[model samples]
Target: MNRLQLAKRLAAMSVVLPAAASFIWEELLWLHALALLWLAGAAICWIGIERKHHSGQMRRTIHTLQAASNRTLNHHRHDWMNDLQVLYGYIRMQKPDKMVECVEKIKDRMAEESRIAKLGEPALIHYIQSFRTLTNAVQLRVEIAEGVHLTELPVDSSGISESLIEIMNAYRFAAAPALGEPAVLTMKLSMDDHALYAAFYYQGELTSEQRFASKINQQLEGAPLRPVEAGQPYGNMLLRAEWRA
Candidate 1:
């Protein structure tokens, strides 16, 4: 039951209470029974409110986490695609030195992003690692700090991943036909004792600013389940969500 339900029940009970008290055989018994009923109602109301609040918060938190995960996946996929393209060109041109250099650099970058593995969430990690076939022609790069670990992540991380996916997809879809290729979004993941952090840097130009902004606001729905910031060069975004250990 929610707050409205509890309120409705209380209203109904309030009407019944007067009739109930009047029918009691003794005044003392009526007084005691009425007091108990009122107390019960109040307790129910409080519980309803608390539950409702908790449920909403949980939903938002999960969604935010999921968005992060999805964006990370997409970014990884973008980078992997670039590597494949470079390899294809190198193999065709027979440029051994260039191929080796690029391959080594990619390896280094992958190692840096691998720090997210310490977050202790397999589903999210796997999903992020397999980012490909995104809704838009966007590039994503995920980087994680060294020696950073988030020991106790929630069992389900799809919510935040989904949030990120939604944002990107919406932005790309809203871009006009003339807008052409999507921008690159660099995602960096980190965490402290209290929160998980996701910092985004976008490096693409949108044809229609108003349309993109409108789509983004609609996608986010203005609910910061976690603290977030957005502004500056190319409108980068940040999310800092508390994590409980």
Candidate 2:
């Protein structure tokens, strides 16, 4: 086990040992007071240690998130600058069609991002939007079907959000495409018959297909969503999940 878990176990043992001693030694009944004091001290120390560990974890999480945020901002800035340069070059060349196409691409990207932001879960939205900055293992595209609001659905929003995150993580880490080719995963979220559905279309190779399938199954255990169908069609993996009320 990790050091933190080990330390917690030791602290618990310390508290339990004293109580056990008091209970075992009848003649040391008078020592019950001492044992009680020892237990109390140990419990307080355990609490302090737990709090300190959690505080450190929180700080680390915040720092990592801030770093991710900064990277995302820088990447976006670079992309915008590139787009502007392309637009400027098109203008200089008097290529109106190319310029229009570039502008349309930008607009489409903005519209998709807007829909992602409105997914109704802050963590899900942030994770989806910042996924590219976090990793290049998978080229991820998330599309939310129009008129679907996760928060408005009569289902477990947080659970669904967490499950989707887990599902993405399974694919993200397992992604290992062939030489000179990157893995691509397109996720489409939609609602049907008062139920939420997520469909993942993956185009690439995995280092270990069995391991990836195992990870997906493990994450879905007891989750709010369950797999509807998973298969490989025309050499591509397609996975679909439906929210179970």
Candidate 3:
């Protein structure tokens, strides 16, 4: 059974045991004490179980954030190398005009990258600082909506940040190319009613091979990975929240 069901069962036992002890064994004080002790143990166990559940969720959040950060860094390194190569080629050609244009383009790209890198700077940096051992081979692009401020969200900043990271990582993995140049991944976040909405857009063209791998006829209900066709490779992944009455 689920955690909530288990908690409810323990609660019912706790109430029933105390009442039964009082009515069926009035003269047995030791029995009454033992029943109370059992009830107390059950309560403790229920609390521990809840704690563990939350802890596991937090751990998963951290892992997702780490993966996204690594992907972003790798993408940045690849782009930087590509820019340098272009600059080198222009220099060798001895075309002063073209060389100047290449330098200007590289500067503009660096400025944009620096701005994005600053948005999630310290927090994202600290999370992935220890991940110097892994090799990353993907490209990513993070796009923050103009005039959007993540700090204005009503939820805890850390949770919102981690959720963004998770969404980005999911997009990175789903959009990574199996061949040819890596795809571009964009992360956008907005807010409504104390809830944050995130959207990840990946640009690419879906091939016949992807359509065949979908197993459309055999899909289970509520599958985590849903096959979406958006006029070929340009599709988006969205995450949102809803309130219940």
Candidate 4:
């Protein structure tokens, strides 16, 4: 349910509440019985409103993550194409020394990208590895805490993997130019009886546009699950889901 639907349910409850309460207090047997029915209806309405709110929050969070992931993927595609063109031009120039240098640079870059791009399910492991690879390329450090498991989480494994890849790609592209030296990207994964969680930390300030896009995407989806706040000198991304075990 959306805000409008929630409001309507609340309004219906408000109207029925007083009528039912008054009839029940008056000790009018038949009227009291009818009031009891109204009260039950009001309770149902309240439950609906609450469920809607929870659902809305979840939806918002999921959408935000998805949009961020798509943007990252698109950015990678653009950069990869541009890089290929440059490599192509270098090859066509027929300058042996420059071609060799260009080939080496392109080869290393492609290799790193491939490592992250190749990640697939099991999503928990893939995300942990991908985050580690991305942050390491930037010279950031990552630590995986104990208890992070992917085995029984209540989320789509493929979707989680895709989202993680997209976010990492976005961070890499955004920070590439600013990287004066190699930086580190760190990740930690843990799980318990009740939940599964993954956390990523990268050095550098995330851009305003990235932050804004994240927020907009979250609101549009209506979910409470938003990215967690990071401390100074680091940016963080947190993904979590309830566990069935």
Per-model CA lDDT versus the true structure: 0.64, 0.80, 0.56, 0.56
Deviation from native of the Cα of residue 9 in model 1, angstroms: 38
The true-versus-predicted C-alpha distance at residue 61 of model 4, in Å, is: 3.0
Clashes of each: 18, 0, 2, 22
lDDT of 4 by residue, 33-103 (tens): 77667777777777777787788889999997677566656765786788778778877887778778877
Q: How many residue pairs in model 2 have overlapping backbones?
A: 0
lDDT: the better of candidates 2 and 4: 2
lDDT per residue (tens digit) for residues 55-167 in model 1: 89899999987887777667767878999899889989999999999899888876765675665556545544544444455555677776445444631245555555566
Greater-TM-score candidate between 2 and 3: 2
**Judged by lDDT, which candidate is best?**
2
Model 4 alpha-carbon drift over 4 Å, by segment: 1-26, 51-55, 117-245
Give the clashing residue pairs of candidate 2, or none.
Answer: none
Q: Estimate candidate 1's alpha-carbon lDDT, on a 0 to 1 scale.
A: 0.64
Quote the lDDT for 99 in model 2: 94
* Local distance difference test, candidate 2: 0.80
Q: What's model 4's overall lDDT?
A: 0.56
Return the TM-score for candidate 4, rounded to 2 decimals: 0.44
Top TM-score prediction, candidate number:
2
lDDT (0-100) at residue 205 of candidate 3? 41
- Candidate 3 on 1-245: residue-level lDDT in tens? 97666785776667786768667988988888887787777778777777877888899999987787787678668867988898889888888898899889888776555544444535644433322222233345555544334443344445445555544444444444457765555656554553455565666543443542243212312423223333333356555532212
Model 3, residue pairs in steric clash: 204-233, 206-233
